[model samples]
Target chain A: MSELRTAGANPPWDGLDGSDRHAACMVAARDGDRTALDVLVTELTPLVWHVARGNGLDRSTAEDVVQTVWLALLRHLDRLVEPRALVGWLVTTTRREAQRSWRTNRGQVPLSVELTEQLPTEDWLPEDEALRDDRDRRLWTAFSRLNHRCQEILRLTVLAGRAEYRAVAEALSMPRGSIGPTRGRCLSQLRELLNAEGGSR
Target chain B: MNDIDPRDDDRGHEDAAVLTDLGRLVHELDPPPVGLVERIQFAIALEHLDVEVARWERAGSFAGVRGDRPGTITFTVDNLTVMVNFTSTGERHRIDGWLVPAGQHTVEVRVADHNSTTTRADDGGRFVLSDVPAGTTQILVHLVNSQGEPGRTVVTPTIML
Candidate 1:
């Protein structure tokens, strides 16, 4: 996998980083091109969704948060001068909105906290209906058992889209220059969990 | 600087492999809901949406004194704050709302997977959308010139009505 990633050595989607592409799309959308805005929405929807859901919001609330972020961005997009700030801005907004959902329904149990209780140890992929194989199912179970912070970091990495370690600093609030070591530790933790069962069904 | 660390590169490879497995696991586990893209597309595709995207400030619902009636939901955007009270009459839902800093503008109610309704606000920034079927929905405020070209537009997130 690493070989394939580094084999090209050049980033995909034209060497423009994720933020640059997003900002460019925003500009085009502003110029009356609906298609450009669609591109922006498509590119960032996953990132925004994961940011909300990964932080512990249920699916419905997470989707709400994502839509809220888009609406907010529509108002503030022109105010954002630098393009690179886009990802950081979107992730932070998602987290804040998800927290708002929590505050609104204080009586409602948080999906993240109630997760373990809702799903017994045997079923880790409860959120997923299409579990392809037993090996993946085992890995998911171990993953679900990860602490919230670890789960958050790994999930953001999955959505970074070749964003480099700085995405950790920007998205996860990790200190600058420490994402490499932090990611290494997090991965080793998962490796330990997977290897415990020989990573098989 | 000194020579590149071979162990560091090897660890990088290891981390990528682990993350790949992690990605596969999570993607399969919590898949995004179907039709998310289309829903967002419809919400974002207002005739004059590119004018400006309104930022969400705060939202809350307050119950009545007796608690027997449906609660009122208040949604605040940067340029406007909308307070919606829902009442069901016969087979249709009624959404009575007010806009802040307000004047008459076209209020469009977007229902997910359902038809939308448009209403015109009064001089007091108040409007009532009557005979609307209840479902998951949201609102958009549009300002149009005398020539009928749209000006600034404000959008709210899709919510249940």
Candidate 2:
């Protein structure tokens, strides 16, 4: 922990990077540093957003889930045993909250129809309109081609960055060892799709 | 066969580059809703860290035929239930709120990027905040324990007004 903290007098709190930074920020936040808490919220919100979106939640619902997860963190700040595991804790909480919201939205559907509804559909994402550039459109088109698991894994791993593989793996319930290979295969498959489209064009 | 595949190293490097590019593209395409972080920060900016956040019960929007009626929403946690009705008058808005187990309490309406309005609920558990600027808002009910000390605060999720 001392190593994670900055050295020398008047050292800025922003010295650490990656998970170490998160842990340091968490420690500072617990010690009543509002600035550290703000940094944590700004830095981690995107990862939390992707986690919620990856769970197939609509925009509004995902937004609510993201807020709820952060509120939960604020409430449980002292109870979090390992500040270093903050990403994993947040990812897992987001998934749970997203699933809860998803269930609430689908509560009216009959049990028999619910299973079918659970299957990934080809509905247009709200973000589709934002993909204006031809390159972005093409990449999204290929991204949409992958299976639900592949899409989820790729989206989360990429958004969380390479340093957060352990957190992503644990949150997704996938073996830690499999994330790298699976991500590799998924990227390769995406490239193949992109190449095929390029050829056709 | 050797445990190491020569292509593995190169593929890993290539995958890293592609993933990085894809991450950028993904962000460009599907960024979180604008101001979401700031809104969350504003909502959680509580003076007391130990507080109870009321669960969102239900919200209903009623568009008046002539655009006159008010929209109502409610939140609950444990024994406390807070219900607020929103009515628009010109550009500003009015929030009339009621708390269950009716009693006197401090009611604060927190508006994002704006100074929060704090008012006291009457003995009947009624409070009103008038001329509120339109933006994201949240309600906080400050409770007093039987001993008349500062009890746990109950906060509602961010609501659009």
Candidate 3:
């Protein structure tokens, strides 16, 4: 089955970017629409998990951190200043929680630098049984060869889907205008790495 | 709102193809674990949500736990803290927990909104919640004031038992 949901078919709400999606959901949620909240959680959990995992947390730990972020969001919903900033809010919050989990795992009492900390290298998407195909494995290896910033930018762009550059900027402190350039550079670098490795047709 | 124009990105079709491939590969590598949506659904059903969030700590857990292992976790909010012990009881879980500093409070183990069970912590802060369905559950510790109005409420991170 093709996994391209909302790819060519622009639904009435499909044109909305990441934050806009969250904003629309938030509106429904504030009106006591329980289903809307479920939509928000189901759609956004992948993004939150990616943010936490990209910080180099192991699978279980990343799951725990993402759970914490959702719980915290529940407690702070009314206090949210900008409902439209939900993607940015989730990104920033998930990162901080991931960092806290990272620190606690290392027995640190205080959280380190917010944005620039290097997490202990972890097998995030460890070789899973589902990825036994040779080409998929090679693609994983090739993708891993990119620097941290490139990997993050690519994943963030995918999560943001049609590019809410502002939400992307909030997730990783990049200049909004530079996201396109960075994405281009990173994709080229990934392509070169794959070619040099002679893997992935 | 600044929107993205793939056309304005000035990218060759090859780059777009690569992004598509990468997205498919990553999604296949590790999709969000099943039951994640159900778990979040249970987590957000706070009747009174303006309560303090008790950040969680994996105080203790058994390694390689699968079928019938006991596990414990701790969550803290302000000076208040709660620790829950889970013993797998077939398809359900028996939850025994305690409050820090030993105070009298009401502890509620709620699965969804209707299947809620409440217990009172004793003077020594011990409480037991039984027969909770082995699914996503949120535990709330509420201290009520003189007029029976809730004063301080501490909640655990949504936990899968």
Query: Using lDDT as the measure, which candidate wins?
Result: 2
Q: List candidate 1 segments past 4 Å from native.
A: A1-20, A107-125, A128-132, A161-176, A195-201, B1-14, B47-74, B77-93, B96-106, B111-116, B120-127, B133-136, B141-154
Model 3, DockQ value?
Answer: 0.45
* Of 1 and 3, the candidate ranking higher by lDDT: 3
Which sections of candidate 3 miss by over 4 Å?
A1-21, A108-122, A145-149, A162-174, A177-189, A199-201, B1-14, B59-67, B112-114, B145-149
Q: Give model 1's docking category.
A: acceptable
Candidate 2 chain B has its poorest 10 consecutive residues by lDDT at B58-67
Model 2 lDDT on a 0 to 1 scale: 0.69
Instruction: Write candidate 1's Cα lDDT for A94-196 as tens digits.
Output: 7777766666644444445335223323322255446676667667766766654456567877655334323333544334355555555656777778778
lDDT tens per residue, model 3, B1-161: 33332334566566666677777876777567787767766777677765777777753232223235687777777798788888888888888998887777899887754478899988888998777787667888998654667687777666665
- In the order shown, the candidates' DockQ scores are 0.26, 0.33, 0.45
Q: Look at candidate 1 and tell me the lDDT of residue A160.
A: 56
| Cα-based lDDT at residue B135, candidate 1 | 60
Fraction of native contacts under 8 Å reproduced by each candidate:
0.41, 0.33, 0.42
Q: Of 2 and 3, which scores higher on lDDT? A: 2
Interface RMSD of each: 6.1, 5.5, 3.5
TM-score: model 2 vs. ground truth: 0.75
Candidate 3 lDDT, A1-201, residue by residue in tens: 123233565333345655676776677576666665776777778888887766666667676677778877875676677787777788888878776765665665434543323332234557745576666666677776665556666777665553434454344443556666766777887788777767538
Each model's C-alpha lDDT? 0.63, 0.69, 0.68
